[model samples]
Target: MESIWVGERVRVRGIEPEESELLMEFDQDSTFMRNNDRLHPPRSKAGYRHYLESGVGTPNDDEFGAGIESLADRRLVGWFGTNGIDKNSGVFSYGIAIGTDFQRRGYASETIVLLLRYMFGERRFQKCDVEVYAYNTASLNLHQKLGFVEEGRRRRSQYFAGEYHDVVLMGMTIEEYAAAYSLGTVESS
Candidate 1:
């Protein structure tokens, strides 16, 4: 699980203290967090330091980064990871965000695909889930493209921009992931 994952022209490696600055790709960028319903707000450098240390500080925790060629020579682009794992039920949640400079290139979707493969195929998790704001078309589209189905809607759950917003819950079980990825179904384009 510590080995770096390479796919879709990017590399995903376990998070490190070096990646503490790297986390700004997800934490400080509000636009990136738009689709990530469960993420807490952006934090200052010290705040982000504490946050990353507690969440993925352990080498065994499996938090990782998805990065590509440098902005100039070679720069880390973004990150994605899992959390809230219920070991007994094998259910867990996920988060992802590409850098503002590196987004819209299928990186987020690819990250989810690679991570889902690791979770369902390698780790044999029973299910994996993610939540998105109801209005986030990109995130909703990405989740469905990966075979996650709508599970429920949690109404009026978040307050932002001086108003409340509803959130949608979606999930995919190992069976669904296997069926979509393992079978290699020809998805409609």
Candidate 2:
């Protein structure tokens, strides 16, 4: 399938069934798993294949997954997409995770921008929201830098690593996204 979204450094595409093993590897990443809250146990190859297949042709699926491929080397650097998409309200929550080897290379930011463009410009989403743990300062700063306004916070709601952390909620409207990147004017690399 053709890429759904393309950025200067990466492209967003659906996760293929053959890539199930790759996702299983990502699930085994200790550092990546630690940062994000894991509600379920790690998945086996077969389990992950089922998970990936479930999203196919399901427009209103609670969690939609996409693969982030680096344009430079055509490697799978990350996985991300919208979760909890409300069709009627045009609102959705997003989550992203880049492999440890791919961290600090600006792939997250580029991937996020491309996802926003697709959501606002193509999907016509009214608002995009994200919840981040307070301990993830880098993500908080990145969201703010991308123009997501801090809407609210839940005080010490998440317990991880033997400490309670606040969950910060941030959001951005389509208008705000337009103002930030000018949508169609972004030059692809």
- Candidate 1: TM-score? 0.76
**C-alpha lDDT (0 to 100) for residue 171 of candidate 2:** 96
Global lDDT of each model?
0.68, 0.80
Q: Give the per-residue lDDT digits (tens) of candidate 2, residues 87-134.
A: 799998888988877887888888888888778787778899999887
Please give the RMSD to the true structure for each candidate, in Å: 6.0, 3.7
TM-score of 2: 0.83
lDDT of 1 by residue, 1-189 (tens): 223255645666545556667776455666566555445655777766776667543545444433343323345667665787787898888777667767677777766777877776666578987888888887788788878999999999987656688888999998888777752233355
